[model samples]
Target: MKKRSVVSASLLALCLLTLSSFSTADTLENIHQRKKILIAVDIGAPPYGMLDGKARQSGSDIETAQLLAKDLGVELEVVPVSGPNRVPFLLTKKADLVIASFSITDARKKVIDFSNPYGVIQVVVGGPVKQKIGAFTDLIGKTVAVTRGTTSDMELTLGVKEISGVNIVRYEDDATTNTAVSTGQQDYIAAAMSVIPAVKKANPSRDVETKFIMKTFPLGIGIRKNDPELRAYLDKWVQINLKNGKLNDIYKKYFGVSLPADMLN
Candidate 1:
């Protein structure tokens, strides 16, 4: 009886392992079979993803997703995601890839794998030119707006804990944060470098300028952990595009600067 029970357990384990292997391989083949790749993008984040005057999706991230679909020879279906939900969308199978300006971090690596970085962004502290905010000490007693659940949010949160009198206001997205800054609802903003330009252009009279850079993070395409096939393809795709200047062109068109030399290398 004992021997029979042990043999049954071994067979069940083997069956589960086989199924896991099949699921991993399906990550890539499923796209080819369906002729569509579902990518999650944060359309509310300007310069990365946004809607144009025609209400059509347009931005660097949008173009990157389109390029990936073109190379895969598949139709592109964009799944709109926000900072808080990009990982959830990928893990829940709502998106096969997340190209939503997701910064690769150690905490996230434990849950999902990331492809080679396709872009980089600085977490910045920005305020009007007349205000003096060059460091955390400078932020004392000032309210700084930040998009919820973003790397900028995390960085700023960690940065202000030990520093007293710094007020951090959380918003749902960059658009809302931009509004808060433009309308004087908030004194400053903790955000990506991209958001600064958008806010500055929209409110030219505000003269918003970056005060200090918190840290730079590499942006990676988020994929489910254990999906080796998908990660492999994305890794190769990023390398080729970066080397060929296609990615830089997209960055320049939106951000007015070439991709960082360190990233291109």
Candidate 2:
């Protein structure tokens, strides 16, 4: 009876250990086993990520996610996330990765792991050509619009030290912010440089142009913290694509130019 009891106890311990290992499996293993990878993208930010006329997800970020899925030999599932919620989606395990124009910053690095940079984006002050906005300091005491909770908003609100008395007008999304600028409701708006062309294309009457760069930052793929295997995979994928010119092709398709040199550095 004693021998039988010992065998039962050992078996139970083994079972528990096996379950623990499975529970702690890395994201890469889970993705491979599930045959699908969920990626978070901002469908509202066009030229980077957004929905097309057919409501199908289409844009640079969407294409990049598709390429990643292909490389992983898995199906792609895109989760539309806004600027504010992109990090939360990854933290909650709702998405395996976030490619939503996520820029690397010292503050954000504390909470998430970012893959090697895949692109560079410039945040610039944009408004009507006649607005006479030449630099960041020029917006002093003027109403500047930005998408609420975005890097652009943060820069205008807190990053620009030399400027003071700038009135920031926050909106829910880029379209709304652009509308305010286009309609003369806002003095000027700051956003991704890509947004200037998008806004001009959408509203031809609006003569918006980038006045000066507020900040230039490298955009990285967001991976959940402690997922080293997944992070390594993404970093390798970015390096490979960059060497093969596949990444530049994607950039040109959306931005009308090759990937900039500074992004690689």
Candidate 3:
């Protein structure tokens, strides 16, 4: 009787252990099981993500997400997000990861992990040719427009404290912010370097150009901090695609220039 009872207890323990393992399947496993990977993207940010004339999703980040899903043999489900909500979406499990031109910053790193940087963007103060800005001090008395809830906003906010009378106007999206600059609502905009050409196209009279560079930020994939499997996979995936020229192809297709060679290296 004792021997039989002991054997039953051992079987029960094994069953419980097996159930626990299945219940704790990580994010990658869950994605595979569902046959879909949800990637958060900001469709409002052009060059990084946007809607084509036919209403199709197209851009550098969109293509990168598509490549990720294809390589993983899963369907891609994009969760449209803005700059502010990308981290929230990840924290709340709304998506597996964010690839929406997410720049890696110390504050963000404290809350989430970033895969190795796959690209870089120069944040600058863009203005009309008549307004000159050779240094940060030049921004004094200028109203700078920036997209709310973006790194550009945070960095510029901090940067202008020493320069008195530097006003900043915030907009909800990149398009609106660019419009503000083109329409003379703001003399300058703190945005990616790509914004200059966009602002010029919106209103040729603006003739926007980079006045002064705030800083260059490294763009990376945003994942939950504790996700070792997803983080490792993404880091490797970025390096592999960078080396293979696929990522650069997407970057050049949108920006008309190749990614920096160092990122590939």
Candidate 4:
């Protein structure tokens, strides 16, 4: 009887250990078990992610998320997010990941983890080629358009103080900001270089050209801070795709050019 009691106690402890292991499985494992992953992407940001003519989400970031889901052998569920809400969605558990052209910054690093940079983008000032603005200083006393609450808006807002009398006009979105510039509602517009091709394509008669680059920043996949397993998997995924030229292929499909060599570095 004593021997049987001891054996039963041992089996109970083993079962408890197994249950604890299952309970503490990392996020990647959970995603696999659930057979789906929720990805947050900015549907308004074109070339990166945006809505199609049918109002379905489609773009480079959407394609990237689809690839991730395929690799994971799971279903992809896209959650539309904006610039300010992307991080919030991740932190609030509304998204399993964010691939919304989120730039890697020291401040963001404090709140969320970023995977290895998968791409790079340039923030630039663009206007009619005939416009006299040549540099940041030239914007003084001129009105510049930018998407509200974006990095371009922040950068231009902060930097313009050096050149007194500049007027910054904030628009609700990039399309609106581009329209404001193309229609001469604003003298210049600050935007990502990636969006330039689309802008020119839409307004073929407009001679918009980059006046000067404001900044170049690397974009990374946003992940939860504590999910080391998921972070490691995503880092490896980026490295493999980058080395295999898959990422460049994707970029070319959207941007009409291969990824820049500097971006690879």
Local accuracy by lDDT, each model: 0.90, 0.85, 0.88, 0.83
Q: What TM-score, over all chains together, does every model reach?
A: 0.91, 0.86, 0.88, 0.83
- The segments of candidate 4 whose C-alpha lies over 4 angstroms from its true place after superposition are 1-25, 182-184, 262-265
Off by more than 4 A, model 3: 1-25
Across residues 144-184, which tens digit of lDDT does each residue of candidate 1 receive? 99989899999999898899999888988778888999877
* Cα lDDT of model 2 by residue, 228-258, tens digit: 7888889999999998888888999999888
Cα error of candidate 4 at position 182, Å: 4.2
How many clashes would you count in candidate 4? 0
Model 2 score (lDDT)? 0.85
Model 2 regions more than 4 Å off: 1-25, 159-162, 262-265
C-alpha-based local distance difference test score of model 3:
0.88
Residue 167 in model 2: lDDT: 80
Order the candidates by TM-score, highest first — what do you get?
1, 3, 2, 4
* Tens-digit per-residue lDDT, 73-138, candidate 3: 999999999877899999899999999999999999999889999888888888778776877788
